[model samples]
Target: MNYSRRHLLQGSLAAGGSLAAFGDQHLAEELERKLRGRRPLGIVFCVSDGMSQGVLSMSEAFSQQVRSQGTVWWNLMSSQKAVMGLMDTASSSSLVTDSAAASSAWSGGQRIPNGKINVDEQGREIESLGETLEKSHLRLGLVSSATITHATPAAFAATVPNRGQEESIAEQYLNRVDVLLGGGSRFFDPKVRKDHQNLFEIFEKQNYQVIRTRNELLHSKSEKLLGTFSPGYLPYELDRKHDEELMKKIPSLAEMTEAALSRFLSSGDPFLMQMEGARIDHAAHQNDIGAILHEQLAFDDAVAKVLTLTAHREDILVILTSDHGNANPGLNGTGSSYRETNRSFSKVAEITRSTENFLSQCQQELRHSKLDLAEFFTSTYGFAPSANELDALMERLSGREVVEWSQQHKNSVGLLGQIVGNVTGVGWTGICHTADPTQLTSTGPGANQFAGLIRNDSVRDRLLRLLPI
Candidate 1:
């Protein structure tokens, strides 16, 4: 239970080392004793899809500044209640792993190529954790801020050659998954799917209560539930909080976690639930610092809710991790150091929308007549750049410079990220996924199994070892 960073790093260097080799026999015995009880054991995996160490640090700092308390994840580390480790997130094909392969590593315990979901290079489908657990009579659930059919969630529930086969993924959810919550109504709607199959109707006929709004999800009492709040991915946490319609329609990540937990608890059967803050990856991909901070914080809130639910229960195991690092963001040092960095980041609270959404709105508004770029930035982002900054942005908008810059950066989103970074001290390395090792924290039963450094696929190995076969 008491592990120093040096000890963890030393253990990490030994590729063949495992939880038993770590010499935590007492903890393992304790977990075994707890598992021997009559109540079935439950497992929950919480993933912030693209969070890095820098992202965790910044989000914890921002949470403390705004709420006078550190995030639940940081508090867990500070309290040493969670066993922490590093996970190398690489696919068989590349060092940098996409969400599909990253999650597949955890789901199938295999090193598949990037862009695959629980499917190996041989074109064979591997049994995902969800399918395996469901076969063991364990209730299964998948929740995400992104669509349920998105790569992260789909990697757990469905096995496909490509992550893009979302329609097939949605169909797979019908009998396999007990609880499914998130967006991607388009994949299920007859109007949007190329095959024109009404998956929702099929789900309804299967006795699943399909809910589309926040209120419906909250009131649903069905044993099998499907909630889709958006046609595509849900809005960013910052945008959802600022928009009245979104606040009403879309459930927060914590809300979805709570709902999923409610259903799983009601079943009285052992369960495996994977909850993902999928938009953390999207925001990081866009290099939107404010969006990333809020999304990570939202994920932390869900972690807190799970901790609350599992407070006194030793039968539950909680694993919190990220699939991979995106955009490698950090709070760059400034003249005033900590004070200036805090001051600059405090401005993120004023941001109500993502740069992508704001730009879309701007394009819609500009179709009528000429628009003042300076005023628009001021109103939308809560800070107006100087006249020169406005002129430069305007020139980029007018010429091919935007396209050229995007080739080097992350398109227009990268340009906006640079502007925001100038005001805030946050900086991004690039707009692509990094091969950096991500953090993993685990508590409750089998927590020691996840300690120290391991490959991403080993996470699945440890979880399977903890499950009662």
Candidate 2:
């Protein structure tokens, strides 16, 4: 490999000395069994579902946007190079893998068909990583920016037919889980759906303090607290960051990660947690550049959370990665490969969310009319518009009829590029998932299993090998 990649792998594996015993992949299984009852194995697995290669690269390029001072996650991600691998993201049926199958590659340690979570076609059950950890002494927790029942987080703890069977999924949490945080209040509130089963009651009956607000999530006395902050996915980080009081009310992905760590750590035994930057997927689906960037910033905070707690633990294994690439966004280019227009992403939050929201609403017309919507957006979002630009817009719209794109437009980056393009004039491909292998970075105990290139399922197998249920 080249020097840049080598630096990334070495920096991420700085604690390689502790995991030297598992260097032999052939011996990985035996090493995992040896860890079954000995070490305090802590696994913090992150799934950046639908996280495009573009988003992955962009987040690193602009890590400081939502970065806070004293965040160890930043330091850990910056110099720590992860063992980067490209896994074939194909499912049993299609070239494009859905969230369930993508997640199963890691959760079940065996790839399943799309729409299934660790289950065979006959519905026979398979042991999940969460069940294995619970079989051991570790605590269990699941958090995400999307609904808790979302495929990635649910893969570890729950199983069901339709990934949309969230109503039923909420009921399953009535068992041994300690912390469940994220959006999906709709799944808990029976009123939101006829069959939601009013799971808030079940969680309460089981002694799980159902927390609805941020304060409740922070202060709940019950060891098992279920915090469902939003009915759907939480607001974009760009929008949330604009409001200080609003930002504090709903826990960011990082805050949820911190809460999960604190609550799980109380078990006196190292636990397992999964942190997801779900919006990166949503933004990709909508091709919303602003949403994708800000949520990524929010996710970086969660990375910081784990880094803080594990910086001292030489045995904890922290893995970072995305499932698949979506709407591959990139900075606009110019002559020869369009390299000149590349934008510097110091911090994604540096761009206001209103700008993002407005861009999504009206971009195509701006392109055809040569009317930089950025000016209209500037005035609408509180910046001033130039007289020349205002005249250009008026002249363009004066007598010309407008054409609208159809909803069937499937290319995500195309949609996103059109919107963000008109706003910022950045160029990118149409919205679509790239079959590229994702980057995998790891630290702490059992990390040797993450060296070099490996399959996505190899990640879970490595964790299972490390914990030895």
Candidate 3:
């Protein structure tokens, strides 16, 4: 249904009966709007799990270099239609928040300590947004590039004292969430679960069409669907893009977003859907510039999909934001007059694997000679490391300490990220979450509520105010 602003306001007024009880017309209208809500048909909450401000700009530049075009997020921000804001994120216990605490603040309307999902610092279980929406008969869906039961997605629906309880988080979603997509088949596979409870069979019995692999997801016509594409978190976009097998098996974040949204749009019901680009945080934690940029670009593609799908639908609001910032990555000037900066930054496009994958490969090929290791590094990173850099990396990989300025960069992944960054012009602060606020961009009906600075803990109330619950 096409709902005009005037029409909704008129309905609100009608629902309030006569406005005479209020002395002022402005007060009456405000009260009417508050009672009726913005009442969007659905809200698409898109999260780039740990995207800092620098990541957004880097992704835009990266897209221009590789895709021959700018990112959807860059275009959206430049357009007058988007409402911009910054989210003040934090946990009750610390200034720098973890994913579980940050996401819990958004879903539970309060800040808890780090490492807990929707559970307060005092060990009380707060009702998650999914549970509250379920009670109101509104459907909820979750999509991510991380484990389906990972912190970001789990916080929306599950209340657990410890965020590591993937099995418990998986069980909590059985009846509450209407649609589930993303990785973590191990949590659902009876063969892998410690208790050996077949979640797939249980979901099938509940009328959910359980599926795995990209082909099944695209072809299946089920309204209620459960799809898990990997045993753990999905592979990094850079790695997946280079692997034909992964391309055939794992669906992109945009594809999963489309599948989840299509189900809710077809139902024509009031719903809340969270689509996350989860691995951006993982890449950031490892200080992987190439992986983080590719991940952010993938997320921007998903944003484009959402905007295109909802272009003509006035009742669907799309909110794009992040939970927190991680290892703030930025491009630094290189050579005289910074002329070499672009040349250096352009080299990031040549990276073929995530630093995590690079480390994994190194572990498997530990016995290789230094010359063989140099060749492997050159093949994977598209640039050869200096002899001293290679020696330090080898030492770090072999569990020997290499003196580093930041204590955080002493690990293999951190050392490798810096070595690659020396060629790519990118630099990382450290290998952990930052206390900085994250970017927020919103569009569609009810987008104005998210304008200006938003507190993480206030997000739940703001979302509920716009939605009819």
Best by lDDT: 3
The TM-score that candidate 2 achieves is 0.78
Q: Can you write out model 2's per-residue Cα lDDT over 241-315, one digit (the tens) per residue?
A: 777876778877887888888766656566778888888877776666667766776787788777787777666
Q: Rank the candidates by lDDT, best first.
A: 3, 1, 2
TM per model?
A: 0.90, 0.78, 0.94
Candidate 1 lDDT over 303-395, as tens digits, reads: 999999888777888989899999899988656546677678788777878876877776766676666778889887789887766666666
User: Please, what is the whole-model Cα lDDT of each candidate in the order they appear?
Assistant: 0.83, 0.66, 0.90
**All-Cα superposition RMSD per candidate:** 5.3, 7.8, 4.3
Instruction: Judging by TM-score, tell me the better candidate of 2 and 3.
Output: 3
State which candidate, 1 or 2, has the greater TM-score. 1
Q: In TM-score terms, which candidate is top?
A: 3
Looking at candidate 3, what is the lDDT of residue 432? Answer: 94
In model 2, the Cα lDDT at residue 341 comes to: 42
Residue 136's C-alpha lDDT in candidate 2? 72
Report the lDDT of model 3 for residue 224.
87
